[model samples]
Target: MYLYYSFIRVFKYLCRERERRGQTMYLRSAARGFLAFLLLVSALHGYHDWTVTYTSSTVCALRGSTVEVSCSYEYPDKLQNRSTPVETLWFTKEDHSQPGGLVSDTDYAGRVERSCEEHSCSLSSCSGNCTLRIRDLRQSDSAEYKVRFITNQPGGEYTGDPGVKLTVTDLKVKVPHWIRLWKYLECQSMCVLSDHPNYVWYKNGQHAEREITKMFYIKEGDSVSCAVEGSERFHSPLVCAKGIKNLCNKVTYSTRTMCVLQGTSVDISCTYSTYRGLKLKEKYWYAWSNNNEPTDLQKDSEYKGRVQYPVKERGGSTLKITDLRDTDSAEYRFKYKSKSHEWKSALHGTTLTVTGLRVEGAAVAPVTEGQRVTLSCSTRCLLPGQTSYIWYHNKGPVAEPESTMNKLVLDPVGLQHAGSYSCSVRGYPHQSPEETLTVSCIMCILCRD
Candidate 1:
């Protein structure tokens, strides 16, 4: 704020000077160009100095445990170089400046080095990754961290000068701590919602920079990797998401975390842009079935006993299930609803390909509360990058304009998600039978006595 105010004063002074000499044409033109150049330089400076991105800023950690802050960077081509290695300093802005505060100053001297392999200004190392470990973390460590990188720009270089801040909070961890007690755990992770100043994640052993939910599950022998770099799954092949963690460079500080299950509790999460999410009031977690009806698992008994929405800071929705079984498999989904009544859906579906089950499963009825479930049946699909996908469920018509694919994810499937799902490709002019879809699924019991 101090620098911002100082810059504003200088900017105003410069403008006043230009106005004072407006009568001089030559002076006016020169001043205008000078101002423009300054503005561009300012933007560039802010771009590098102001950025403190994380692969996965907020990490979900168990209470009375440790959590790491994965902070990374992306600088302009000119400003970032290997010889003049950019020094990343992690500390509390004002609280503790005694050369230390949350993360030890000397701790990351060697391990938290920069990576020149990918992004010239990337942060990574061999000992592990660019993760900041917080030991004996208190409930307060659940706040954003002011992560800054200090580097000098040549005196005449057209570089930028800005400060970078990344959040480092320990959002509540999903699933019981006992689950990871005694397993090599090649897969599976819980949600950790937080508004850290800067946050990032290193799954397996690489920088999870993209913010989308890239499921680690792959086809047989497809080489499901434990390294964060190996996660290639993007579209849920079920429901699309709004805040699905994409590991991309985003302007908003808020984020989402999605978990994929092979045969158990499925947790779907979404985080919004940072500042706008401060006073979180309502975060509606929605789902659909094969029929495309909206369903709220929060109130439904099917989820009432097991589902848990742990975000109390800036409201968020969480769907948790226990007693992992084949029958509990289904296309689980969710979306975000804010205070202004604005709505955006990142709903997704997960087809539980039940391999081992006794009785033929049936569609679970949306018990008497008369709730709503959203069945995504559109031909429009958009990926993290460019190019979109189409969605379809049951025999619904969701294409008017050109759509990517004829795929739809049935969320919160009650009796509707139970219907025979199919989708007709878009741009085919007529709903051709060749482009139709038929969802093949098996059912089972959710809980055992």
Candidate 2:
């Protein structure tokens, strides 16, 4: 699962990069073809005899959360008849036959759990598939894990090499020094989280709204912190915005992140200030790119007619993008220079995500009558503001009162529910492409006989 998830993240990142650069369809095709080749290689490597296949090569899990490492193994079926009894062990240290190197023998005694496909062989014997689970993970638990199986037959001892590596990390609130009215705080981790979990924010120990952005203004004494949605107890340390004393030479954005619809317009704004005596020389907005020097948006040909820097207000600047495209998604930052000093926040800038609506769960195999079906309005990221959904049946609006919900669930669906469906958000003019739902009835087929 981790390997597959990693592939998905890579693919999405590549796609966004290509789209943002307005690359040709050929490039996109090449990316997909390369990914397919990798998948084929992985499949071939996993099916060989006397092989152990792990779900993921590496995993990054949050500290305090449970971690499960799973693997499946295959050996000659002849081993089933052996009388010596097979022994399987999961360990992080050097391999030992059985009684020595197991995780249970280490510091993880109470928190470690081992399970396998064969329940009868509980102590250490297992065949086919096995899993190791650890609770209340700590940073010290980060290590390479392997499973070794031993048999009485000559040359029957085998250990899976290059085992899964686990990295445990804790969330931290990154506070950026900003002299602007808006202060943006980021919840950061040392490793990328494959699941892309939702974040929960807290202000002065009070829960904040789900839709609030990190760019929201903070009062002088207010302290803010964040945690992953499911693990609120393990939140980051609260960092007070007022505690930042050296805000004299910093640039800060209006928001740390945004998700906007395609074809719409967006404004990426920021404010900056330097030491009292420093003279302002230049100020501009630039999109971040790998190993490339920042260039002014107004001078970039890629954004020829689409980008504009509106009139500056006091100490603020805004980059207005019109006729937005999916390729416009990128991290943008503001920079200012004085005669003797230049400043751009060392922290990351605003991340803009452009997305389109789509109806999911519509192309499943035909649903049988009397079975429930759910269709959802899906977006890459949540859109800004109070978002309400509007559903459509065929080309007309759905008359059901609950059609306003993001999900349309039909309980014990009937033939009448079969049709083309689409969805759109309220206040947005665009609607998703139509998807057909087919319902099959056993009674109707019997009646025909």
Candidate 3:
């Protein structure tokens, strides 16, 4: 008989075999049989002496984001004493007897990571604490995963049962009927996430602050959208009231123009605001060419590894470029996309000028006491504009008469003037490395001789 049928027969027999005088003997016998069956089944499955636990049996995550699943495992003292775990991994299939059965299958290549803490066999707690992290989640990536390990001892392999189950979902915004003009709009997902993450609201397409209650009030001709916090890419479709969509569009650069030295790094910053209901499809930097349309600099071979777009705040982003060259001088602009595209290139952009910087006077030289010396700071090109220079003596600001002067003069140099000196361009963050100046007291030296 099939194992399932045999269990059914045993259950039926237990039900029919009533003890005389309605005593509890039948119940006791049934309980003992069930316990014995469980033990037999476990032994048959090679799980007789091991225990595994999952922090959460189920996990729900948004598409295009990342998630983590946590787990732990333990084994018998006899196995611990005789063997040591050499390889630990996670898989979605029990046929690990074959290759390519890992949970990080071809479909999830380069997107899955597993981390575990190594533990000695003699430890009383779990032998391993493992966590699985997956990035750029997709609908097809959802599945149940199991933890497995191989030991150094001969024929020592184990797989944990009842592993974690994962589900990926997309976000959506729920709007009420237009009849109620001032009702609340809801940001929802197809299924509830593991921990019920906070929701964020957007109007016209730009991200607003997080909504504590996952609700936004509706107004006439207003288009509102919503997304889960930290998973903005998986936002829901826009829900508009009064059958009209409001267009919210604005972009402004922190400074219209800036100048920097070649071989240095510079940051171009900007703040933007967009309509609530529109979704941002793309964001990038571009520069105008000679009589041609602007070209995206990100794809240019020149900026392959020298450009960075740091994480943006709610309404701002920064572009940082290093190892700048004269050729890098151009008009730089930030552009973003939405479902309802708006092209306003003329209103938002920054002009950058790259020039070489250097100190004009001798950095290090011996000077006689009572002699006068002059140190001047200069740049290679002054077409863009002349920048005021700030001089420092011994790592501190220069004296009042020499302050804010590109050319610093020290008359009647004394022993006290024998120290380090440096200069920097005003409004620039970097300063030249300090140069040492040696002043000699010939009279004192002659006396010592």
Candidate 4:
């Protein structure tokens, strides 16, 4: 069962690594081919008893707050009876030169804790769970975390790969737009908080009735801010609701930053207002240039075919970019022209980050017959939603029981499985670099003996 699980993990690693590295199409094609072969092998073997399951694959938390990541694991009772756990560790980074680095050894030294429980399960298996708690979260603490345990048996260490991803974000008070009557304000973060925490609103630097909601209303000229209920110290920056006179010249973006996968599409939008009765002459989106000037995206040759200005309602405009490329990453600002005035705020605009997928692990490795193998798909940033991955062998797609799964497993590998492998996100053309799988025949070794 452990062998079977290991194969699955390997496949997942390959897929993930490929996406993260954003390798070229040739490499990605080869890696997909290898992953497909592994998936075929695992499908023939069926289920495995050894497994590790995380309560949540992704978590979002506020800076300065506390968070807990938990998972449960199961192993065959036969191994449990003969082997005892020698070590258990939780880590954000894996060190190939040694065992994985513990969270405690990192900057989290005084703020991390771990707890575990173990018990027998149905006499044929043993089950256990472990929870990792991190306090006073820092923005730098955002990372993918994995748990590993070692047993007394030879080659008895296992790690939960494609582990939990943690995102730490600061609070921001979304300024109310004129359409909302300039009365409502919202507390925002990059990702949804895992705890679904209550929010505390502040008016003019003072607690506003200890408000327990994410949205709030403010009077003209009043400044509003927000924080998690118990974390008032980390409140968001203040935003002034300065009436029409101040709002008439302002532009407000829907978001400050966006992370997207290469080959995907993204839309960045904003709302703007001009002095009353001013005839709007022109409106457009532009990216910052090295010359300290804003170049209209529509006029730029680089964005000619890929850029579109989706017509929006009265005060809103959207910049849509399709088939995203890494080179597209930049700060984008919105500008509008009136007959007598041009509005372009000194404040920063939206930032877009484009990441490509790359498969990780060795490009070529010799596998002995009957050895378990795994491949994985990965990305630099934890993708926003559940991502579906496609595996390829040689140059064509590989058939698998679960087409959406990012992992490919080969249990008890055979010579027929040797090939070039690659992986890609479903619905996207980008793929990870190819990985070559080489198989060594066990019968040949026996014959020599």
Candidate with best lDDT: 2
From the highest lDDT down, the ranking of the candidates is: 2, 4, 3, 1
| lDDT value, candidate 1, whole model | 0.37
Output the better candidate (1/3) by TM-score.
3
Off by over 4 Å in 3: 1-48, 77-83, 94-99, 123-126, 153-155, 207-209, 212-221, 242-449
Q: Looking at model 4, report the run of 10 residues with the lowest lDDT sum.
A: 209-218
What is the TM-score (0 to 1) of candidate 3?
Answer: 0.45
Model 1: lowest-lDDT 10 consecutive positions: 233-242
TM-score of each: 0.23, 0.48, 0.45, 0.50
What's the lDDT of the predicted structure labeled candidate 3? Answer: 0.68
Better of 3 and 4 by TM-score: 4
**CA lDDT, every model vs. true structure:** 0.37, 0.74, 0.68, 0.73
Q: For residues 261-348, could you state the per-residue lDDT of candidate 2 as single tens digits? A: 8888999887665545357888888888867888998898888899999856767899999888888899998887778766643345
lDDT of 3 by residue, 234-316 (tens): 56655555543443454557765566787788889887656564567777777755486655567778887988888566667
RMSD of 3: 20.7
384-448: candidate 4 lDDT, tens digit per residue? 54567788878677767234445678787788777888888767777888878788899997998
Better of 1 and 2 by TM-score: 2
Worst 10 residues of 2 by lDDT: 118-127
Candidate 3 residue 95 Cα shift, in angstroms, is: 4.5
What lDDT would candidate 4 get against the real structure? 0.73
Query: How accurate locally is residue 316 in candidate 4, as Cα lDDT from 0 to 100?
Result: 86
